[model samples]
Target: MTVKKILGAAAGALGLMWVVRAAWGIPSAIGASMSAIQPYASGAVSYRDRHFHNTEPGSQIVAGSARSLLYSALTRRNAGHPRGVIPLQTPVVPTEAADLAVTWYGHASALIEVDGYRILADPVWSDRVSPSAIIGPTRMHPVPSPLSDLPPVDAVIISHDHYDHLDKATIRSLVAAQTAPFLVPIGIGAHLRHWGVPEHRIVELDWGGSVSLAALGRTREGTDLVLTCTEARHFSGRGLVRNTTLWASWSIVGATRRAYFGGDTGYTKAFAEAGTALGPFDLTLLPIGAYDERWADVHMNPEEAVRAHADLCVGDPGHGLLVPIHWATFNLAFHGWSEPVHRMVEAARAAGTAVAVPVPGQRVDPNGLSPRDSWWEDVG
Candidate 1:
């Protein structure tokens, strides 16, 4: 064989061997090495390719453009990269003690406190959001809260099996630290179970299916909290195969308040289903970052987020306060780091929607929220 051909074959063989060893589970979470075994977990496992994205039977991926894998990648900008430096206003920390509160642990990770119960959503504490930590999109900023110091959470709600949302290392650490149950959508349990989490500790639900914690387990306040699995228009996968598991958003109804956690998805009418079935959330944690014209339909822009809140609340524009996530921490999309929030603010202002753009760790209430104008401008 030619020298280059021989080297390529050797590298491919090594990659195959790596996948076989890492698929079972990691030995430790403290410093778990990244692996290439991306697990596919979505409801549309049978038809997850481009056919599912079409609006109609044979419609185009976009209105008029042909879909190509290369073009489908999220937008990227070379001019306004963060220069590998971001500063916090003052080491902001998320609060755990509140009747209704949310602490953004940078990106999509949040500590949600409602009705005296704590629920964590899409907690990605890893440094990178990809199958291999050595490659893929690394975080531009540090996590707000340390994993070891996290307060006891009632439940950990995973939206999907994406590396960013359902991190294996973080999940392993969480299982060791807290005595909470994991609430995930259908098929995600396979991934959690594979990660060495106890079967009894996991509660998996499908769209509109509900799991009542008080009925199944106990909480600090001795009050029952309901987590309803809501639908989202998104695809999921981890390894060479995709969509073998389910993906979903979540609606958390605690004793005193109601909150919605939209993990990661494109724009879809499914939000209306969640509203009709679950409805009128006090706070909606929506994805408003990593959006572009190329993938805007699947991912809502900021204004679309406002629209989604309205739809989730049955067309009431200002029914709930919008807290934005899925941005600021990772370099997943090519827009300027803060572009999503900026556009969202402009859209929210014109639409009369309430929004609180909290610093990564800052806590916020659905009511009596503060408006921080131009917070991300400094970072950009």
Candidate 2:
């Protein structure tokens, strides 16, 4: 064959190899098959008619048709992206987890410290939040810190089975790097099991279920950190099959301090219910992004997040520190990249709530928080 023909053939082979590799990752990325997940999910109160239902009656997408949503997503691809480079901070992880501190790792990933126990929540370190690595909402900024750099955590908690929140690659990496148990919502353990996570490492819970950190055999002596799977008005699915698993918020209660992680959810009265049952939290890491009127039933807008924070704080709006999550890391919605924080701050101020807007990887001790700054204004 001539030189040009040989070159073309070699290029074609390389392209074919790349395609094959990408395709191979898709199945695992989509996580446990519906059949594999059913047994673990079937018994939950939320599970009926072969799918999980939200406590409140609502659709994930309320205002727009799928085709219209798709068209807008395609046309306004850059609408959610930041105008400037997203600033990142290298986290300064202490030798011991603090009594009440949290390190925001962008998107929905956060490492929360409550009463000297570290809990990593909804950690998604992958480049894209889609089943296909090459085609999805790619991270606008690189992970602020590598997963290998994380301290030995008491538990790794997942709020749902969505790709952005419950990543397969990150779970696999954690399985190899950390000895912590995986605390996930019902049916999520099947995905963990499918990802080769040892059965001993998986602990599945339905809403209102509680597991002691000591019971998991990972906590320090006399530590009484109880992780409760609290209610969240959200849906879950990694692929075409939706809500095969339960979606939830998490309440981390220590002997003295408490924290609530509203992984991803719409506004729901369940926030008050959680506060009554497991909260009056000292710190709340709630989602304040990926919201749109079209999908408002599933995602909370900035103002709703403020309201949720107060509700989680047992109706005392100024009770605790509120650090925003689920924004600034990915262009998942059509709003301006900085809009969530801006609106969140305004609503928080109006409600007498204390708020902390940390840059990715910046750790905040809710006890000794600094004055709020407009770091996002310069970035976007």
Candidate 3:
């Protein structure tokens, strides 16, 4: 073929690829729209002005010059990524759930075991946490394990509807791989329904609402496991319009043990309130990344995570095993890759808080907690 014809054919192929990529999975990935989600969200007390509002007014982004922000975005594309390969561990899933343990599956995804019941929290096994697979913040490290590798869970807990925490692809996989019901904040069930998740598998709850494992027909030795939808200081959206659904933290209560999963949030007094109402948690998995001065109201830094842990422990910092989540998996902010864990370790040390910094996919049993190791330093 002539060079001109070859070039023309190549260009045509490129155009077709771009179109196919953009159209594939984008619409479904955006989840339920505002009108579709309203019926589920409107009755909640936090719903107002056609959107869900935080108890304490919070800003997603603080005022700043657009030009400078744009410049920084363009210039510091690699600011949040690590300098070396992020190490991964093959998850050690036991034949039966432990009394109290957690498996960090990167980002906000974790498997929590309490009182012999296995609960999966925010399991996003997708490579990209965005509506479009061709674009957006890709995973810094590959998912430690595939969805198929996970054992049958008693329940699945989702904190919010953000892409990172509530993924369409992962939810679809979970529906097929496991029979666990998804207990989520109000209106997130709409998204699940939109994605073809059966109604029986979706449980929606407002802040302070809860459901028991026995009620869901999953019981262990006749012991009940309670999952509560607690408050969080964050916003939720899958597209341009925001907060059509509620965002939240989760309180996992078993017969003899309690744990808190702070999916993603900034500092909030609600932590103290949760501690008083349903805490004195034995294990706390909290966010300690994706924080910036511009959006300080929504994302907590390491110090704030430590404070949140303390608050959940009812001001007793030395109470529980604090496991840092929301970092080391994806690049979603402007801070250094390992900055959050470094600061968290320092804060925990000063506050006398017990912390476990696990590599992606590593499991931690609060009963037999190990000393902290600087596993992330070489990678970052």
Most accurate candidate by TM-score: 3
The CA lDDT at 203 in model 1 is 87
Best-to-worst order by lDDT is 3, 2, 1
lDDT of 1 by residue, 1-380 (tens): 99999999999999987776544333332121122112322344333432123221221135655444345443334423565456543233344456677878877899887787889899888897765645567777777657887877888999977788888879889989989999987667767777788989988776678888887766665677888987777766666444556678999887677889998888778887788877788788999987767566667788788889888887887887888989888766657777788888888888888889987777786655565666677777
TM-score of 1: 0.81
Candidates' lDDT values, in order?
0.73, 0.90, 0.91
Judged by whole-model lDDT over C-alpha atoms, candidate 3 comes out at 0.91
Candidate 2 per-residue C-alpha lDDT over 255-339 given as tens digits, one digit per residue, 9 for 90 to 100: 9999999999999999999999888989998999999888888899999999998998999999989999999998888888999
For each candidate in turn, the TM-score is: 0.81, 0.94, 0.96
> Which candidate's lDDT is highest?
3
User: Which consecutive 10 residues in model 3 have the weakest lDDT in total?
Assistant: 63-72
